[model samples]
Target: MAKSDESTVLDSGPFYHGTKAALQIGDFLTAGFRSNYRPEIVMNHIYFTALVDGAGLAAALASGDGDEHVYIVEPTGPFENDPNVTDKKFPGNPTRSYRSQAPVKIVGEVTDWTRLTPEQRQQWRERLAALNADPNAQIIN
Candidate 1:
């Protein structure tokens, strides 16, 4: 990985990752929040970080994050927390807490989908065409 003077990316392991708005640069600096410790709720796991795919991440950002850097993070072992916890914040039932064993990093900045390059647009179009061709693919508005 190319190391910039600002920061460097570190690999944890084959795990899930999530994206959250950089509420502020301090957002990434702060430790992750877990649901298990909440007094009102039954404790599940100690260290939980939410993980989502590109589409899910986009939906999450649209629901809240906005124009901010999305912190992509993954967790390691200590499988104490339930990684599949349902998030009440957004529809479609996206997972909330994933277990993170390593420090999180600023992966990329979020921007409008129209900002995609022609190459990216073409690739997405091809992928969409393939999905549309699949009889089992559900077309939702």
Candidate 2:
């Protein structure tokens, strides 16, 4: 019997947008309470959800109230570059630099609560009151 010389290889390239930025509230409930001065009233509320498309990404940044706390959601991806190599002079040679894309910028801020309707304000107040009364309200994972 004789041995055969055969091998397999792979190629890699940049395909997607790389990085994104997000703003997280250090203390959401505390900030809301402090702003409204009403433990039973929800003042600052922010929520964020993200989805990816073919070549672009979309995010929803919303606030329960017109408070000063706003939600920010950004895009993110793997930081490491591909390992498969091509265009090499030799087996153990550096081909091209392995570089990854950078994060995109996503900024947001709470403007004013005055824009909220009376019904919306009342809804927020009720939600806050419920949370404040429930000991398990802090459980968010």
TM-score of each: 0.28, 0.27
Off by over 4 Å in 2: 1-47, 50-73, 77-104, 107-115
Candidate 1, lDDT over the whole model: 0.35
Model 1: per-residue Cα lDDT over 1-141, one tens digit each? 211122222222233333333443323322433221122233233232333343233334222435423344333233322223322223332443333334444343334322345576467656756755676754110
Could you report the Cα RMSD, in angstroms, for every candidate shown? 13.5, 18.6
Across residues 93-133, which tens digit of lDDT does each residue of candidate 2 receive?
Answer: 13322212333223433322233456764776677677667
- Window of ten residues with lowest summed lDDT in model 2: 51-60
Per-candidate local distance difference test: 0.35, 0.29
